[model samples]
Target: MKYIVCFSGGHSSALCAIECVRKVGKENVVLLNHNISEEVEDKDIKRFKQEIADYLGIKITYANMEGWEYKTPLRVCKELGGFKFGNGPALCTYNLKTKPFYKWLRDNFPIEKGSIRDDVRIIYGFDKNEPSRIQRRIGVMINQGYKCEFPLAFWDRTITCTEEIGIARPNTYKLFKHANCKGCLKSGKQQWYLTYCLYPELWEEAKQVENEIGYSIIKGSFLEELEPKFARMKCKGIVPTEKIKPQTFWAMVRKEIPDKSENLPCECAL
Candidate 1:
């Protein structure tokens, strides 16, 4: 009997929450947030989550990933393999987000993972502009046998009916182009360049982690190889056609920049 809205306080997610409130009333709409501490620093996501809740006058709950309180995407990259999601699901998305939130739902509501809970409808923040992203998520939900809804599916603008009251924007909105992870391992070389240019300390910390754990954050290229401009070209094609130690392989990777497309962030990065 709960209407969960994935509230990230971003343009699309925030608007979607407001729409949910309008449809189901504030009492039924619960703002479910997955707050990433942004690794190297605090992004102050709490402040924005509060703004969204206050503006909508809805119930807000912060979900946490058990045993992963200190784990960021960068920190998880060094565990076994490099920063590749592989052909299967990305562990970071499951560990950092989906697992904790769904566990909360099952504990409070009358629903389970595989069973279709007709009473519980999850509301997503996808807009009409991104049709493919919307459908992709819908397909995943269908396969999982979960009931979901997109309240903003037909909406096009960032400012919705609820934001008409003149609520202030979050300060962290200016930190990145998107309101996702700060130094996400899924980021491409161009994104890595932006991360280095915008937050060198975060970028440097990732490199230090890579060197310490003997695994690059990216699949083939290490963070140290994330060069600017022409450096992007050098970081690619580092894995030679021979077997070598992980540390030696990453060291060799730093000798050249990777192709811009090689490390592009996947949809789950958001």
Candidate 2:
């Protein structure tokens, strides 16, 4: 049986890949990933992916959309004329990631469209802390006719597999909790503000996209509307780190900018 690990460029996924290789050997393991544009994805994420591939003696298999190479999330929003579909991830995620992956599986395997395959087992990187997410993923994968494995969820201890293999974690983790696109459209004000501070170009593009699509990334507040506020906070040197709680972060922002009593909501951009 082949073990197909969804090798997202993060610590948990990295550990999952390593453990999969250890169990079934590299030949039977596939490190499948979807490529996002460098403008959004950190360059170090690619480096870390390559490094992990080398460590496992396997090549990284990319399943990016055929004509969407180097396309940012904003580009997808512009082309699709929507940011998301009814409480799901941003359209770019479905177009750039989910679509291509399933296409690759169907094209390469004997599995027919909407059919199940017993030969391949899908793997995810959910850790034990995420029981809800893990259960949800399992249900989804099983419904799609694939068995799933989440090694990190059952592992005895947390492992920074990259460090064990003498590689540094992607620098994006220092700035954000996950190594997702810098301006992920699914994110809310907190993430967008962080993007405004750390990646102004992408933030500018997001603002432009919002204007074009007539939809705000944060439902009520457009990125353009929040720009001046974000700029003020940036000027005041008040950017929240990844670990800061939303309540605490907003409280501090309000304390600094006393004129605004509005608290921004946030979701994990990943």
Candidate 3:
């Protein structure tokens, strides 16, 4: 049996990798990463991933869409002339990350014919503080007949644990609450603004995508129109989210949250 941690080059996922490596032995643990090329090209996220791997001393592997000519979400949005957004995860979440990751899992770790053994365990990084998210994630994977677990939930480790481990967390965490794509479709005014100054090339692509779609990625203003409003503004460190009360198991089963595995255009695309 193999245990896979869906490493996202972020705090929670790194902690999960470390603890799981300690528990199951590094040979039994693999940090399975699925990435959007834009994340590496624009945000330079690969360096963070390398740091995590070196620090954790665990074997980390990646599953990426090498066959897809359009390697980035911005390109996909431009090709489609827009994307649908709602309460669900972003379109790229499936098209770029989860779908490929799932396909890799199925191909390499084929389900044995009529075998009942649970040969795989996938660990997601949702922290103990995010009980509702943890429950929702587990519920979705369970519904999909996956053997999933949340090590951070059990370990009760958060971002603080990353510091305790003597590794600096991903820079995206300092800029935003979550480590997502450089020009994520879900980004609001603030993130776009930061991208505009920090990564003009990616931001320009996003602007072009907005123009092609004839819709703002956010609610109202176009990226160009909104750029000046936040020009020269300092990056807001990890926006604080309002507390959603943790729910019971039954409540999670009953909750109508959208797909949890690809719930956000997050670092893990989960």
Candidate 4:
């Protein structure tokens, strides 16, 4: 059986790729990735992906969107017409990620007789805490005649390959929750605030995209409308680190800036 790992350049996915090699041997494992433009994706993420692929003795098979060789997220949103926020259908993700992935699949592994491909298993990096996501993914892949596995979901403990393999993780994990695009349009206010503070140029581009598209990346507030609030927090030295809860981070911010607003939501549109 060939184990094709959806090798997203995140810590969890990196571990999944390593564990897949350990289980089935490197010969039977394929590290499949979707390459985003460097302008959107961080350079450290690209480095980590290469390092992990090198460690596993396999080259990453990139599934790239044909026309979007170097399009940023904001550019994708602008050209795609509008950005969908918070659980709605996101055109950028579908066009940039999902469509290309399925195209690659069709080109490589054709479905025969409308049945699941028993000789191939697709691996995802969802952890044990995400039962609902796991089930949903299973449903989607099954419908498409693909079998799926979640190593992190079944493992007793987490497997982070960075320490054992001596490869430095992408720097995104140090500040952001996921190693997503630098200014991910699907992210919540917390991530946007962090982007505003760290990547002002990307933030400015996002604001411009919002203006061109005539809608906000966030549900109700344009980035321009939200910039002043983020500026205040930045002036007060408030920022987010990886995996910090929304309520807790906001409490710390309130201590410094004292906003009477209710706790902000940090759930991204994953």
Structural similarity to truth (TM-score) of each candidate: 0.72, 0.91, 0.74, 0.90
Ten-residue stretch with the least lDDT total in model 3 = 236-245
Tell me the tens digit of each residue's lDDT in model 1 across 1-270.
Answer: 668888866666777887766666888888888766556323555566677788787657878765465777666555634554557556566667887876776677644556766777777887678789878887876665566777777634445643375665554454454566766665555456556666778877788877877766567787765443323333342322213444654455545434444355432334
lDDT-wise, the better of 2 and 3 is 2
Cα lDDT tens digits, model 3, 87-114, are 6566666767777777877777765554
- What clash count goes with each model? 7, 0, 0, 0
- Model 3, which residues run further than 4 Å from truth? 38-44, 67-70, 85-88, 112-117, 156-160, 231-270
Give per-model CA RMSD: 10.0, 4.9, 10.9, 5.3
lDDT of 4 at 75: 81
Error of 2 at 261 (Å): 8.5
Residues 1-270 of candidate 4 have per-residue lDDT tens digits of 999999989988899999888888999998988888887888999999999999889999988887665676678778878886456668788878888888888788889767888898999999889999999999999989999999988854445558777998888888887899887877888888888888889888888888888998888989898766676676556654647898888778777655553223222211
**How does model 4 score by TM-score?**
0.90
Could you give me the TM-score of model 3 versus the true structure?
A: 0.74
Model 4 segments more than 4 A misplaced: 85-88, 155-159, 240-243, 260-270
Model 1: weakest 10-residue lDDT segment is: 233-242
Question: Which lDDT tens digits does candidate 2 get at residues 169-208?
Answer: 8988876878888877777788888888877778888888
Give the candidate number with the greatest lDDT.
4
Candidate-wise lDDT, in order: 0.64, 0.81, 0.66, 0.82
